[model samples]
Target: MQSKIDPDMVDLNERHELLYTSSPIAALPIEILSLVFHEVQRTRRATGKPMIPHVEITLSHVCSHWRAVALSLPSMWCVFQHSYAPWYGPVRPTRERLAVYLERSGDHPFDLWIDFKTNEPAYQRLFFPLLEITLPHVHRFRVLHLLSNANHPLKEFVEQLASASAPLLETCAICPDYSHTSLTSLIANKADIFRSGVPSLKYLRMDETSMFGFLPPLDSVVHLRIETRRTVPSWIPNTAFDAILSLPNLETLSLSIELFELQAFPSRGSVPKEPIRANKLKHFRSAYVLINIYTLSHVVAPSLESITMNGVDLAGLDDRPSIPNHVAFPSLRIVAFIRAKGGSHGARHGPNLQKLMAGTQNVEELLFWGKTGIEENTEKTHCMLLGTDSAPSPWKKIKKATLNIPFSSPTEILLYHQFIAAKPNLEVLRVPPRCLELPTFLQGVPPHIDLRAIDESEPPLPLCWVPGPDWLDTEEDPFLFYCRVFE
Candidate 1:
């Protein structure tokens, strides 16, 4: 029997081929189209924006050839993002949509992000079916993020993670709505659920008090950030210190703790006697008020290169009942003090700075940030950096210095000139725009110094000094500085 080709079908195929050949983008190779899709998805993820469902559907709608190419690539349809809200009615339709993505993914590794906002009693009935579809594909999940309110059924979801194994999982973050404090403790108790599952996990971030009872293998984590709530001080027990000490390969660590007004300081008996040594640690940052600086003395990082203390109380370092004689960071190359408070003006600030800088004599860069406005206090700002005139400046070998403080007053301008004269090896001087116009101030300063005013329109430093993304907002206190090495 001879198969007869219908003239209608043959004509339709010829028209489709003509259209595909005429379109410039449709002519691109399948591999190039796949890379373009991956890059678009990657950029969206990096921006922390919501994901678009049925991404393949959007691309496939372009042309017949594009639809066939998109249907052939499973990874293009792997991302599953859905927001569950009680007001949106039943999630049965959403589950059907999720199944479509899973079927299209076909064994390719995928990323899953689910946001649960419903607190209604019927949420479990609507949400469980979606979880059932997702749990079976855990092995293929490379990134998983579950964000829910305090009252939502997170325990059930966590239980599923504990029971399942995900060898490909690399990044995981579970965050509870900020209003719910009880949920932090609840999640902490069940933290071990994913412990045995995610072997390749590297980055982890969570609320400060949430990881009390649960911790992953410390050695595998290279970067860790712990965020503290504004209402309470971050209280870490002795056992937590033990876990921190066990991290052999940890590199960067950030701790943000704020002490409550009513909270009492911890007794000396509760402080850990032994130091926590992180041999591989490179950068360490402590933000907000640290009740007892001595408590941080326990953390010894020989390889530490940068230290940032923002809004910290340096006076508390000496205010302790008894101050230790020596605290060392031998390899420190950069030290930044921003908006630090609570130190005695002439009494403790100088000695405290000297004690801190004594071990960091080799520091190449020093940054001092102060209030930046027309109504600036010269004495308070100057005292923060140079300390008392009688005391020796701690920065003997400092190659670069950034003074991000206002120089509106003559006294303030003169103080900077005096500072320049003190640092015989001083190379670069960066100041505010106001400082640059002071003709009398510029002519009197050292000629060899590389003096430059900070451009107001430029961006601020990239370090973790500011709390959030609105750091560049004009409402924020402006900071200005510059630096260079004089040969």
Candidate 2:
């Protein structure tokens, strides 16, 4: 049986559409209407995450008028997510679809994320053609992320991308060859691939980058991160260290490269006669980077405001920086000691800690996170910060300290009383309250006291306590920490 169209219902639908169009929002200018869609795009993009096409597609499908407006905004169509990863839901667009999106993206810098993990030859049928199509427009790329293995069959393709001049490239993250290729095999290296120059490049992250001799274009990078998970010692030559420190724009530098030697700037056989200054660097975080005393003497970050060191000696008695910590990091305000192993084995671990902290005159905050290296030595660290007659006091400038040690031992639990007793001039101290039996902890602190309340009108207290890591259950779960402000 054929269905019959009802004229009355059709007329009702037409009237409904007409009434919706007459609303105040529908009368908005095309430019203003575009912003509604643009905002949907910008809200997520501003977070530095990959933009999904669903929003743009949904908005365009709302109506014919909306479709035209969505199509008009080039940036709304700038992202090409080509992936086979389970996390990204596999975005395998045909060559025709990619070409259309590229043309519609206008001259705006585009972002391309390609993750091809599978090694099957038949699965990569479309990847090669799409890659070829994007090559001609590499200069227009703003961010290019290529995720693949060390011996990915498309290495030559990536090598071609390395040679291409990406004048507008701002961030590029890709796995380097990772072939365990050594410096002696320099001929097999692709470190100098961006030889054509990526002038606008600001952030560059890669793996196994120690084999690189030098790249003139690296001076433009502002944030450089090199992380390798392998146990092989990364050969960071003095020439390389000197070159990296010389980067005038380097701001946030992180290196997890292996440091096997103790020499200051160890190369084939050379060391910097004087300290190399990373004047523009503000934040430096390392894992096993400052293992040796001579390593600290080679580079000084004058503008460093924060430092995070892993596997470092909490007691820097024997391996004190050739230059005192304060001298090397004058602007440092934040310091975090993560997983620090002890240096010299002796009594006065507290004094040794005080000595280790002598140079942090300007430090305002300290975080002792992870109990791996410092769990057994917490009392010593706490005693040093508490400041006994023998050990010098913590810097007067320190306003906050966090003890994130997940300690359960009866001996370590006693340190809570130590923190409560010490008048270290800290306004706020965050401790894991679970360490203290909740009832006993509650009895210790006054109920419903605001730490921020004490000010000029009210006399200030020398110290205050707040439960940290935000795990507590009370009547009002949000602000239910029984806090205290007292010396």
Candidate 3:
């Protein structure tokens, strides 16, 4: 065994050992290296970018020890995203790469996303084969996202998912090509795809029309978001509303209604004797484009603590409908009203707005956007809320208030100043940056109040209220001011 060793070979081995030992990254433990690899994958996902095979490929190439560790960890290679980019040419070669991932992932659950950018027959021919190879592994799919055209072979994929026993499936989002108009019909016909047997499925989001035909039990679903398209009217038939109400465990509900075309409402005789109640619902938000206020009167949640209404028209209807005076939201605490343009008129000044505010008397936080011409008469409009008279005011308990609206006339500015000066226990008041620039805006504020300006940064922090350093110039204690933001 001690034959004359080649001096050249000994020199090469020594050089390799020196390089490995000198590298600082090589000193890290295998667990740390694995975490670094996971972080690379997470960064890609957070940016909504397709997963690249180079991460694991490059890590394994670093050294023999690294290669062995990367190969042994299945979780690091479990997420696969295939984005169809026309500029990348043909994606047929990626199938082989996908196979490598499937082999390396071993028994770990997988998260998969396929984004289809084109519907050409040639491209479909190249893409379907990869899907066929991935179909058998559906049982391991934990999160799946499907984006495709109407004519794509999604029907076959849905059929496979229906029959496949996917016990680990948790979240699934199916979106059609944005330009396609047949989404409702396409989803309606596939009613049986996720009808039963998926026990772990929870979070669900879909367009409003997609739920018109059929839906899964969705008993375990905690959050539900219904997005209404501009092309369709935001009308949920009684049966559909009943179906949504059946989800006993639903905690948060969001309805994004773009527009509401007038439809014949049920006659007084046909109105339900008892309003539907959502006992577990804690938060509710609705964004409307000319909706009938009476339509919302049918839904009543006793446990709701927060309510937000955007662009809702309570006074636009020619035949003003009334919300039953008896209906009360006992647990409601926070309320926000973002009035749409042309939404405020002479008719809304008194009964309409007052009635809505009177229902939520216990609200401790109120956000009001009063930019319309009708709101210029702020003194008379908000007089009911200032607790100036003997009548009980719902806004008396409001501790935090945000006013992100225009003040065109001096009278309007003066009226708003009076409004803020009236709240006795108010601790925080937030206004637009422009409002702070007004000559008399700060002078009207009480010395005890913490006045803050809204920072208009990109991706605006609508919920955050922080006292700026500029507040120090006003003789307010810097330590007493605090900043708070909401999710």
Local distance difference test, per candidate? 0.57, 0.56, 0.57
Q: Clash pairs of candidate 2?
A: 326-359
Give the C-alpha miss distance for residue 177 in model 1, angstroms: 4.7
Write down the TM-score for model 2: 0.74
Better-scoring candidate (lDDT), 1 or 2: 1
Tell me which residue pairs clash in candidate 3.
none
lDDT of 1 by residue, 405-460 (tens): 65666776666766776677778766666667778678767778887766534333
Candidate 2 C-alpha lDDT tens digits along 1-487: 9586454776664655555576787888998988888887766654544435556777776666777888899988887655554444533554666787788898999987666555555555555676788887788998876655443435545656656788999877664333554453232123465778888999776656433433326778888766563456555444555666668899877655553233533333356677778889887766553432333456687788776664333343453333344347778787765544333321223432443467667777765544434345656665665454555465666667665554455445445445444435566655554533444443443333212222234211111112211111001211111112211
RMSD of each: 7.3, 8.8, 8.5
Candidate 1's C-alpha runs over 4 A off are 1-21, 39-57, 78-99, 113-132, 148-153, 177-191, 212-214, 229-234, 258-269, 288-292, 311-323, 340-350, 371-381, 384-390, 423-487
The order of the candidates by TM-score, greatest first, is 3, 2, 1
Encode model 3's per-residue lDDT on 223-268: one tens digit a residue: 6665543344534334444446446877666656532222224432
Candidate 2, residue 341: Cα displacement in angstroms equals 9.3
What TM-score would every model get versus the actual structure?
0.72, 0.74, 0.74
Off by over 4 Å in 3: 1-21, 39-54, 82-98, 117-130, 148-153, 177-191, 212-214, 233-236, 258-264, 267-270, 289-296, 311-316, 339-352, 369-393, 456-487
